[model samples]
Target chain A: MSAPSSSSLSIRDLHASIGDKPILKGLTLDIPKGEVHAIMGKNGAGKSTLAKIMAGHPDYTVTSGDVLLDGESILGIEPDVRARLGLFLAFQYPMEIPGVTIANFIRAALQARLPEGEELEATDYYAKLYSKMDALSVPRNFTSRSVNEGFSGGEKKRCEILQMAMLEPSYAVLDETDSGLDIDALKIVSAGVNALRGPNIGMLVITHYQRLLDYIVPDKVHVMSEGRIIHSGDKDLALKLEAEGYDWVEKEYSAGKSAV
Target chain B: MTTETKPDIDIDRSVGDFRYEMDYAFDAGIGLNEATIDYISDVKGDPDWVREFRKEGYRKFLEKPMPTHWATKDLENIVFENIRYYLSQGQVPKRTWDEVPDDIKKTFERLGIPEQERKFLAGVEAQFDSEAAYSNIKAAVGEQGVIFVGSTEGLKEHPEIFKKWFGKVIPSGDNKFSALNSAVFSGGSFIYVPPGVKVKHPLQAYFRINAQNFGQFERTLIIADEGAELTYMEGCTAPKFETATLHSAVVELVAMKGAKIQYITVQNWSSNVFNLVTKRGIAHEDAEVKWIDCNIGSRLTMKYPGVVMKGKGARGEVVSIALAGDGQHQDTGAKMIHAADNTTSNIISKSISLGSGRSTYRGMVHVPKHLKGCKNNTECDALLINSHSRTDTYPAISVRGQGNAVQHEASVSQISAEQIFYMQQRGLSEAAAMSLAVNGFVNDLVQQFPMEYSVELKRLIDLEMEGSVG
Candidate 1:
């Protein structure tokens, strides 16, 4: 197989399935460094499957695929190892870890990235954490609360963003991060994500609505259906799909498939 | 205290788990019989009544059958005749670390017991195998009219207090294991706080089982007089042996009127030992008795530390954490018996099972009719590392009184795939994620332990979680 761009997260013809039920069928996409791309698809369109597959969720088996992280294949690695290699997945539905404080949970994650025998600098970590939390408008007391336990939907999303800010990953996949947030929360969360946007990192914003695009606008957009990216366009494509709905794209995809 | 001259025990000092070889000056070799009891009594020069008391205990042990109808059938594996009930290097306990034997001192040093004693303990009693090697109390605490010494020394020196409450709380006929411990009871802590005397620092006891095919029966008795308060902590560990090692201890506590006694135990037996202990305390009027226990690394452990509220307005609590690794079963819980009006009790137990390990929580709360205004709250939470791990909860609450409330809440949870995956996505390995989840399951209960113990407990849990996940 020819190597893709070394500075991008290249997913080439990724085919995966849960048990015998196929999910991602020859899905191919790329988000190079210094840019953000959005994937728009309805429910059960394999958008979430793609995100979970990249993180190596045990339930999904990759029939054939190549996921390159900066010229290195991370296809069969452990999820944590892949994460340490700079691939982060912000879950659509975050888990509630009872009794684990958000501060300690994130601290452990950061510590895992450090070299053996190296200790995290407490004072520096706290300073950075406090600043990021302040930006997200998360209360200072949330640092001591159990991670996502008894938290509102917005709080969970903000915590996911907080972890991303602390990690500063090379590549990030925001899986439906905009789903469970009201307009007020969406603005704060979008601002948090936008603050993290820069030339050093690549991001894939996966969502079903164009509303999120109005806030954290993506440089490029793609329409995913039936486990594959059927159509690709610029940011205006999202607005067109929002105005005309996926029926137009669905018809076009069927016509393209029938023609082949 | 007589010091016997013998060859030094030779073993690798760096490997704390290696058992040192030594010849016991007093060894009531293999078996439980009348002769063994007589030999032990003769060795200790026990008075007539105490000697007869042990004989009666041995007879009772033979009469009571093991409680296996509802428990695991593994109880049949313990060979009474093959166990060495008594083995000791020296009969007399040393008053100073310098006078303690080199082998025993090295063991305690490796465990960091002496350093902990110096830093935070008011007194420390280090028991090795069948006898206390060293027992000492801080001068200031001693001046405050507190008695801290080995059980043997306490029985001989302060029999008026020790003999009165020795087996009053948990008698020989309480259970099969308790009967065995009573018949062959040896070195354990005996503490007494005088009226109105408050112990500033905790008194600690460290027990080590260093011999194979041995049954360590250490009996402990603690009493807090009226208006007195004290905290006692106990920790135990044993070397890995091919054969099963038995550790059965009977501990009785007495909290007099308005007195408070807090007992903390961190039991870290090797996977080759069976740890069965009976611990109970009596709380008098306006008294409080709290038990904080942590169980780790035992082949099989059955311990239920209980409190009997005998006086009005007495408060009882039991906070416990048990971790069962491979080939381990931790059957532990709490029992609260409210015998008087306006008594209250609370039980919080958390357990983690890994690698096909099993943990059982069996609780008993009894508030009979005619007892007014009694209350109890029980919360049990179990965390499983994978599908193979197992946990069970059996809570029997019998409340037939007016104005009484008893509540029990139990939950069995596995570290969900999504939970682990979420943590893994944040960069933790599967094992670290599982370990964190397990730690979180018991984080609230850990706060009930001492600062030093909670830190050590977290480290121990982390070590146990290694290689638990694929």
Candidate 2:
């Protein structure tokens, strides 16, 4: 349990829905330790839905699926339980929690991870938080400010990465982490994420464009359409997809479905 | 995504755990009339003129009609004939802690008043059902010519200072409850600070209601002389009762030229108590007055602390936080009256409605045409924890002067699902997440309170949030 094993995050036939309409139809993917996987899909391709379902979001019903963390299914547990079991999802649009300082928020998260009756040391917590914030270029005074309130796009992303650094989740799901960032912010955020890469962690980076793949250079590239992965290749395939476009993948998937 | 969805859960309605046997030395029989008023005045050994004042107040109380506009349905249930006007354990307020009676001393100890007084407070006054049990001021503070005593002693000992400003700020016939409190007011704080004296520590008073179906009316008057500064804090708590209990207090503060006065109240009445209080301050030239109020655990509370800037360059502020649990209504706000030039006022109010509770923010800010350079800013925000919980904001702002600037901003928002989900994703339980968000909502204003009070306020809110809404 101390180290992220091979295939730390494995998704087998994940079918989820929002209300009556199905979103993810038999979606499947996996990421092992010491590896980064990128999933590129167009709008309505259920990319964000997959990330949310894995985090046990209440709005999205997992009709039929098996999402495993180290070979144990986490389909029926609550969202907080999933988080405590070493799962983290970086939302595309982080929520604005008014009046809750960043320092208190992170402290509560870390405190929840501890065993019962074990108090979190305030001095050590602040020291670790300050060092991590320094690495992410966050200001020293941000610890007093409310969580994600009046924050810029880059600051929010960096704050997300800062949380990841603090929580030390076994698997990280970065859902469209590069949605609203400028190039400079993207680079800073990517470097922060790169610094967290190690054999103890697995990452699933879901995005709409191949541009984010250029900086964080995933070990595997996935192309998804209509709620399921239709193609998988090495990192060079991302460059190839950028050279071409998503139109070829949709056409090829339709043709393959007709043949089936 | 716009409206936050609250989980449906019934609130816990258990009353407070602190209770004592009904052991009253004397009890004025149930009802309000001339006989009752006369009996109270006779028992307290009131002078002739003050007895006449009580008769006048009773007439006004009879003439005034119930305030039907502000939560009339809850007001209808209060049966005046069934409520006992006064009750006392007959223990006179003593200067020494050891002289106070056993049960009353034990109650204060349970509330941690003596411990707090030793740690931080400059003076303390403990009031039982109808009279002060113990009132003492530190020797160092008393040596600085600080007059702190019960209103009875204030009127009896220092007639020159007490008679001049006693009923001037809040007249006996101001409101129905105020008139009632004036007619039968028993025990409250009376303080007079000499000129140029600044009391570093806060003076506190604790009021506890022990008997059932009793109404506690305390009159508090604080006067800060020219260039003087003072801070006063009062806390109220009551034991649970089957019948309704009424707590109506009248507090008047007068800040003279260049003086400053800060008044803070933390009220946690039982769920069966009706808390209707009238608190107002008058600020003279270049003076400042601030009111920090927090209300929790009451059935119906209708209180609006107000300030009147009557002289040039005066400033006033009101920071309030109200928590309405199940079967409760917290209708609280502030009123600012700018009567002179260069007067300023600021109000920040935050309220939370949990379970079937309802909260309302009713504020009024007025600047006359003759005034110039008057400024006011008001921010009222409400958070609803359950779908059944409700909130309303009525801001009546009138700006007639050309140079006056008045800003009023209000928002009614529930705890969003996204925010809770985000917090839960960080490994916080649903209850913990809700409480954190709520404490954060009032954190800014809570910080303005004294350190001891701020911590206690947070803890009180945390306890109130437990089993409030799922």
Candidate 3:
């Protein structure tokens, strides 16, 4: 089934935790295809945890509620299987795998998406990899180098986006993709993401500041505080948060929830 | 040297009842005794002094007991009497390829030795059972005052040089296997590079075990004279067998002042073989020695190639990689002894364990208090492919001198599910992901080999990853 145009990702009353300590307490959100949704949160606001739980990370236990992709439950599927089903998570700190070249790493992921016993065409694989790398501004020689080993912060982030663009998942989540980028890298990565934006893929950008939103221009903004989203608005809300800061969101959410 | 009239003998038959066929012929009822030793000595027409040395080594072998304390206890199960220690197979080692017997030539052809030598090797020596069937060195390399030939021929031709350094580094009583090798060693490579000479290409030796229940003891000695440099590679394989075969060998290397020597070995024996070997080198003042060892297949292998830096400004290095698959235990490591001032050593060891396999790194790094400006770095990494696989590291580092600097780092990690998932999401299967992880783990060590060997090593790792997934 194709992804749902509206609300391709629907997280309802989600509760997650590591051991007895709850991280994402009753979090709820909706991200639709053909739209870019940004989640802005302060430190310890569970933004990273939310991204991990949606990717089916094994470390966090989803205590309650459901996470659906295109109206189908993906909470029980394996992480890789969930990824093959059109969901992607771009990690903030990518793992360094030595000896595994970038060419082999991306090829294996693309091969997993093919039919059983069908070998990937080497010529076509390199063609696509080279094209993606060119788009991300990654050097041609990087395909032969090991993945993320000894790479600078900007290079790792670009590598993550290169994989995302190659996989072409229905819904994508970028957690702190701009945390370590310079202004030039931020522009290049934003341009790459914008080039991939279309009706078939939905995007979720999670960041600690609104500076990244200035480059990617998110359509909607959600402010997360104390493990839950307490405010949702248009893109102007990010500019407002940037101007006023999280102290305003925290005070507003605590007072209103206590009064209710 | 008529090539057309030779009869077609099935070289596979020489391999006996082993599943993995060896390429050499076998003698009828060859055993280890004074008579057999005398028969060998007389067959080679050795001088009286050579024969007496063999007798003395034989007495030493009988007096020495097996090494039981350091490695696996299962080594005690090897029955020395059950092994046929002396087997020349009636074929004399020939310096020219045309002089080799037809059956032995066919065996080398089957093992792809000739082709390998033609492509990248500067010299090639094919040893079958207990003798070198064929040995050849490129003419240009030979013209440079470099001598590479079988040890037996070396003794016959250059007795003055061969006898002077023989048993000097690895004496007969150093260990039980070494004594056995000294007493009955038949065919191995003897290489010498004159002072100020540098060999561009690597020389290679391929040892094939052709008979069941037979022991192959090949003694190798490489001496790089002052200001000289050389690289040597050796590969060993035996036919699969129901009953186990024994392989006990001794290798000694001497690097004189301002000289360098690099020795590489890729051993893929059948699972029914006991591979117990003793290899060591000595580096004099301003000399360098390196050992690049790779162990792929064997039931149990206990080999620790060591180096003794005996002179000031000397250096030693060892890069070893081991893969232990089902029913295999790879016990391999390196030892570095700093005996003089300004000596340095670096060791990087990597291992992969699959199924019920086990890989252990038992190493030693020593710098005596008297040694000044000595530095040592040792890093060991092991990757477990499955739940039942196991890995262990036992590093003994002794820095007795205040002026010495030593750094030792070890890490044992399993193939993480998350890492595999990350790779699979990129379009790789579970098996491919695991293979990538393993290759990454050992990339640094594998890259130290020559280009062709490194490519072959990657393919071997891929083959090993098959059937390793749950």
Candidate 4:
């Protein structure tokens, strides 16, 4: 089958595997522009694998699948090319690049988008960076420090958010951004993410815990089991999953799979 | 050594890719022998003592075998018989660019030396082939009794001052390359700041070998008198017009009591050039000497700059960065010899090897048994960009003196796949990501360079990585 002709990040009947192990099987999801979505699942539910596969990571091979960015297939391009095509992945484990400052790192990303022979205005760049950093409550001096090196867990998440704000990607995937953040950190991080939400961007916030959903308040919540979406609901679905756990969803999912 | 107030990247990139055809006034026929020495001495109008000095250096060069046991076996490829020992238009240097021979002046213009001398450099001694084509100094620096001139003119004009320190810090027989430089050296800078006179701005020397098959042996001697301060930057950070198959240079620096000297070298020669150099400095009582060197883009380079602390309370430092691309090897490091009590020394060296390139860090530090209160710290770091890129570290430190403290640190790292992937996810292409990682590895030392050199080097690496990818 061909890809979806829709203005969204469309994953259609995705089947992906890492080496000999299949992780994502027949998964389908679509995130249109100007909305926030959340996916909740237990361990080994393939949530993280789906995020990586969408970003074109080399570790996973798509046995049969299609990932589209705004109605165009982005299946085989390089990760960098995919990023420039407006797909962003906030890593579950952000890399520590020694001796590379935050300012220069973001600048390179922005500079790569500019036309050849064009220069990035340093004064305006720094001013915009300072304002975004202030909104995230990240100290100004953090720009000079190496990216994610020696940074606390909270700082790493904030750094990821800062990069997202700077790049202003069209579709952003936040992978467990609240995994290590405390309550105060979560508040600040959610505020930062909320400030960036508008009619111009689509966001997929993936998390294992429902507490993160309370802060960011996704418009739609989906229950993921055995690699594919089992059920979809409003914000109340997150509360139900948080209170009664995924046992009910898992039971219903298996019954449906076995009967089929 | 040259700094453009606003560097032109196109001109900078092509600085060393173009050559000029010249009509030679003198060319010492190919090969090294007694007749060659006599011819060179006669051409320079050398005195009897100086003539004898060249002969002694020739004898040493003939006796010394290639240092292949500890160096690259490629050293055997330099055909001494095929090399023209000396080639020049004349010995007298032109004070104004217009007076310089048109061909030679065109060489310097292509090198973009005069433009770099406009704002950042206090003086310039532009070397073209075997002689200085153009030289000039700021009036304020000249008024302060700073003598900056080519080695040919320095020997003739200021013999009393030049003779006292010539070959004292690094003698002719120090190494095979040093001996070769001493025997056939021409077209290098020589500077001497008067006692207690501080040259406020750095003096730069621009070197270019425009003649093919001509072995360039530059002999540089810089002496800072008692209580004087000076910074001499050499080997201007640009590729040469035409690669000399062999480039052997000997640089000797002297820092007298309470004096300070900083020698900076940014060498980016063509890939066909084989660079072998011996550089050393002597620091007297309470004096300081620092060497900041950056080596990039050569077929094979084997150099180890050293310092000898000769008087009490002296200090020495060597901060260097080296980058090796495909089919290149950068074998470089530093040496510190403490011959006096209460001396301090520091060495920080970083290197990056890409593609199939190889880099090695070889260092030596020594403190005698009698000296007390001596301290030394050495750090070496290597970064690899590809799976086949290689690096090696060999450090020999001996400290037997009472109350002496010594320390050494080393690390080897490759740009992890995850790191590259992370950068790529941020929209940087694979080549640009690798180039930036390499740039970060050497950014600290690149900062030691003057003016916009760091900026220029970033662009150079970006271009290198793109070519490597292709």
Name the best candidate (by TM-score). 1
| Candidate 4 residue-wise lDDT at B86 | 90
DockQ of each: 0.84, 0.84, 0.35, 0.78
Model 4 bad stretches (over 4 Å): A1-5, B1-15, B236-244
The Cα error of candidate 1 at residue B85, in Å, is 0.9
Task: List, residue by residue over A16-111, the lDDT tens digit for candidate 2.
Answer: 889999988997787887789999987888898888889988898888968889888889998999999999999899999989999999999999
What range of 10 consecutive residues in model 4 chain B has the weakest lDDT sum?
B1-10
The residue-by-residue lDDT of candidate 3 on B258-290, one tens digit each, is 999999998888777889899999999999999
Per-prediction TM-score: 0.96, 0.95, 0.80, 0.96
TM-score of chain B of 4: 0.94
Flag the better candidate by lDDT, 1 or 2.
Answer: 1
Q: Is candidate 1 or candidate 3 better by lDDT?
A: 1
Model 2 scores a C-alpha lDDT of 0.89
Best by lDDT: 1
> In model 1, where do residues sit more than 4 Å from their true spots?
A1-3, A254-260, B1-16
lDDT of 1 by residue, B1-470 (tens): 00111212221112236677777999999988999999888888787878878887888899998998988877778888899999997547888889888887888888998899888899999899999998999999999999999888888989999889988999899999998888888999899999999998999999999999999999999999999999999998888888999999999999999999999999998877889999999999999999999998667899999999999999999999998776678999999999999999999999988766789999999999999999999999998876666799999999995799988999988888899899999999998998899889899998888899999888888777764655
List lDDT for all candidates, in order: 0.90, 0.89, 0.84, 0.86
Place model 2 in a CAPRI quality band: high
